[model samples]
Target chain A: MAKILDGKEVAAALKDELVAEVDRLRKQGITPGLCLVMAGSRPDSQSYINSAVKRCSSIGIDCRVKKLPEDVTQGDFLKIIDDLNTDPKINGIMVMRPLPQYISENTIKYKISPEKDVDCLNPINVSKVISGDDDGFAPCTPAAVIEILDYYGIKVEGKRTVVIGRSMVVGRPLAMMLLARNATVTICHTRTRNLAEETKKGEILIAAAGKAKMVTKDMVSNGAVVIDVGINFDESGKMCGDVDFDSVCPIASSITPVPGGVGAVTSTVLAKHVIEALKLQKGIY
Target chain B: MAKILDGKEVAAALKDELVAEVDRLRKQGITPGLCLVMAGSRPDSQSYINSAVKRCSSIGIDCRVKKLPEDVTQGDFLKIIDDLNTDPKINGIMVMRPLPQYISENTIKYKISPEKDVDCLNPINVSKVISGDDDGFAPCTPAAVIEILDYYGIKVEGKRTVVIGRSMVVGRPLAMMLLARNATVTICHTRTRNLAEETKKGEILIAAAGKAKMVTKDMVSNGAVVIDVGINFDESGKMCGDVDFDSVCPIASSITPVPGGVGAVTSTVLAKHVIEALKLQKGIY
Candidate 1:
């Protein structure tokens, strides 16, 4: 069996660092705070809220959840987002996505203040990431992936990395991030021919296909480090990753598990972003 | 002899379409307008300006030249950009780069309105590009290259595209644009090992290395389409491109000449952007 990349342990370490940072800021009369705006109470949104709130509590940072009914007007949603954006104590703002089909995500996204855009979903933040401007934050998940690799002493510089998806949330931005680190990155999607051949060439493989077990044992090379960003459901209704974990784990040099891997690091990265936002708000940066 | 891509011919066709569009917009009481902001009297800058003015005149759009001294302040440049942004006649704003070293580029970039950001150099516009939201203009040269290929009905879907260099103006954004078109894109920089090996895999090779005669005969696949974005000077003083034209042109299926290829189509795209920007201003789109 290969060495299991324990994401839960890594996340805990990150959270500890964030907690220490928060404490230091508290001494400086600054409280790192995050505001989550949930337009409708979907079960998945509620679950995420619970986990995020719990993490905030453990880190001793202020976490506020604003729940709007399903029938909330676009005007009302904007009002809540605007309030969080101006709230001097609120350092980060996250709007739980997949809002009512009628509501426009683009409208909400452009309205978020770039300084408080902790998720880095706003166009201004995304642009800053692309330009290497460093004025804004990268999305929590992609940022966590880079931080995880760096924390473990993995060198991305000049490595051949293959990202198996092209999503705004993960794959596309991850490729840009890897390229910024001097990696020779290849981004393959559904249109790509012979996906396995491409995956086998990766010194590092990042699977974010959103489909359960899309990457199998034959796709990865021996001694490759795999980062699984997909959270999916199996036939038995069990939460899983896009990687065929049981089959590929034995062949891989290192791998992150589904629930414990990227998912765990996300909330902590949000907390870190809050601290960073507070620093910016105070003009410390 | 292989059929050269004939970018000049392709660009002429596109200009014809643009002329019709400009006429239609003019009939609707919106004359397309472009404001060229040149910071200095550099010979290269003046040459580009003269050609752009000529294109705008031929396309039935109002072209205005805003020339400033090399020692102009960031504030003065921004004030001019703001004035143009507010002007009813000026629909697109392009600030030529390589401003005085004392002036901060970022300061001027942020001042240009996203709606009139025809150059797409500003962070706001860059962010829009990253999000795949065409809210603002794309930089002229890259957009021109894409339009040239699209005009020829060349297929980008599933093709292996190798882009040399990573300049934000060309290589980086162009790579993203190609990926958006479903091409399996690889971006190689100075740090990449075996540059020729990477170049050989490209079904479509984009050379933007800013180094004259970098892509030699041995580095290309037979019958590949080549788009050279470089405008570097050869050893004897004449302008050349990243591709070693003499050696590779005979073997390649299609190629763009440095002076008349991508550069020739650039201003026409800027004119197109002006029309688009007017539409945005009028809420037509």
Candidate 2:
């Protein structure tokens, strides 16, 4: 049986480290504050916002949720963002995505200041991440994945890694991070032919396709380290991962379970980015 | 035998099209000046600079070569770039690489104005290319490859592309561009295991690995389109590409020869970006 790479444990340790960093900021008369901008009452975004608030409390940071009406005009929304951008207390701002259908996402993304853009909604940070710019913050989900690998003492250099997604949040940035660490990363997406053939080559396989048990036993290489970043429900409406957890776990050397894996790890990393964003404001970088 | 993808013909045609665009800019009283920054006496950089100057003249744009001493301080170099960034007449700027060992490349990159960063030595533009930002310029070498594919009517959508390098100038950016066009692009670098196995899967194989004749006949799949971007010298001091052209030519459907391939195409695209940069200055974009 493969060993479980527990993200919850790693996240806790990471938070403990960040807590001290936050404490330092508190003593310096600067509170690391995250302004969560929510536009509509989407349950998906609400769930994430709720988790973010809890993390803020645990880490001794401030969380202020600014709720906007679903029917808010583009001008008003942009004006609100402009206010937050200049707010001395707000160190970082995250606009909860899939805003009101009428509000342009691009306009809102452009409106946020790059220094306060903790989640990488701005185009410049998104591009900077892959270009390997140190100033840019890593997208939280991808940063969480890296944290997991480091926690497990997995060597990334010269390894063959296969990332099974092309998402802005996870796969692409994660691949860039891996490539920066000298791993040969192959990014396979929905259009990739012979998925099994591709996955079989990976020493590190990252399943982030958001499908239920899409990666089966036969697709994995022996002793492969599998990281499941997918969150979905199986046929019985049970929460599951993109990996066929039960079957692939026996074959893989190291594996991360769906609920207790990357999902559990992201918020802490998100909070860490907020703290880093705060430091940026202080000109520490 | 594979058909030769004539980059010289494509580049010539592309320049012809740009001439009209440049004419319009001239009519608007914007000459689209390019400032080519040369530090020290690197023969390789000088050779590239000569071509860039020639292309500027042919396209009716202004070219100025600013030479700096090999031992120039970091402050002086950055000041020069700062001056170029604000120079109203200078539309685009490209700094020849391999400055004095003491000077940091990244510093010079960040100092250049993004509007005049036509070569994309700057990290932000490199990232913007993949981030779906239409405002940023694609690095000339990668843009030239795309232009060649477009000239030949080779569709990128849904094609299986394998790029054999991870350099900022070509492989990484080209993969992003191809992915943006709906192609499933796999980037294989030096650390890739079973290199032949990976390359064989691609419908379009791009050889950018700088090693001379690194991609052999066995590495390519039959009827695949091969793009050789590697510029290297063979045992006899003759210029050669990564692909073993003679052996792979029969197996591939179409191929680009070395020296005359990407090299012939890059300068013209570089000139086009200057015109585009000028347009941005005029608020035409």
Q: Which candidate number would show the highest TM-score if scored against the true structure?
A: 1
lDDT of 1 by residue, A1-285 (tens): 767777788888888888888788788888888888887779998998889889877898899988888989889888888888899988889888888865788899889999999988688788777876666899888988887788778898878788999888888788888888988888888987778988898889999878899999999999899999999999999999999999999988888898888888888888888888889989875
Candidate 2 clash total? 0
Top candidate on DockQ is 1
Q: Considering only N, C-alpha and C atoms within 3 Å, which residue pairs clash in candidate 2?
A: none
**What is the TM-score (0 to 1) of chain A in model 2?**
0.97
Instruction: Tell me the spans in candidate 2 whose CA falls farther than 4 Å from its real position.
Output: A23-31, A73-76, A79-83, A86-88, A217-223, A233-238, A244-247, A280-285, B23-31, B73-83, B86-88, B101-104, B283-285
List DockQ for all candidates: 0.73, 0.47
lDDT of 1 at A26: 80
Residue A145 lDDT (model 1): 89
Instruction: Report the lDDT tens digits of candidate 1 across residue range B135-218.
Output: 767788889889878977888888888899888899888888888888888888888877898888888999998999999999
- Classified by CAPRI criteria, candidate 1 counts as medium
**Residue-level lDDT for A105 in candidate 1:** 87
Candidate 2, residue B73: lDDT:
88
